[model samples]
Target: MAELYSKARTKWACRRGMLELDILLEPFVDEAYDQLSEQDKLVFQRLLEVEDPDLFAWFMGHEACPYPELDAMVKFVLDRVRA
Candidate 1:
């Protein structure tokens, strides 16, 4: 799934068309998918459902990120991309 997501990101970046956040997150999102434990997965799911200002802070690694929330998810997502 990680490899698939990597491929998807590559395709999206190399191709010329509209791209969505969900598509960009597809790869890393699944990295910790099953590994997140049930409770964490639920938290992650809710995190995915949100796009609040808090997300921006977390994405930038600012404010130390809130608990088991989008900050961690963004870090995971960025790690995959940076890899």
Candidate 2:
């Protein structure tokens, strides 16, 4: 079956108030989101539903993830950023 989400849709969702988060999220959404498994796409959608401050905390490494799915996704994004 086809995925429920599109890269276009996810790209829009990745826009954030914090430029740091935007820099991290938008590239990953562009280059890697389509490569993600369906389950990870669901996890990413859940991650976007989280507040910017909370997402910033996790992305900035000031706080850790309470959910493993989110943590893994965060790592995946970060890895791409570093590469």
Top candidate on TM-score is: 2
The clash count of every prediction, one per candidate, is 0, 0
**Which parts of model 1 have CA positions greater than 4 angstroms off?**
1-20, 52-68
> After aligning candidate 1 to the native by TM-score, how far in Å is the CA of 14 from where it should be?
20
lDDT of 1 by residue, 1-83 (tens): 34433433433432322234544455545454545556555555555555544554565566666565666666666777568
Clashing pairs in 1: none
For residue 44, what is the lDDT in candidate 1? 54
Q: Which ten residues in a row have the lowest lDDT in candidate 2?
A: 1-10
- Cα lDDT computed for each candidate against the true fold: 0.52, 0.87
TM-score each candidate: 0.45, 0.91
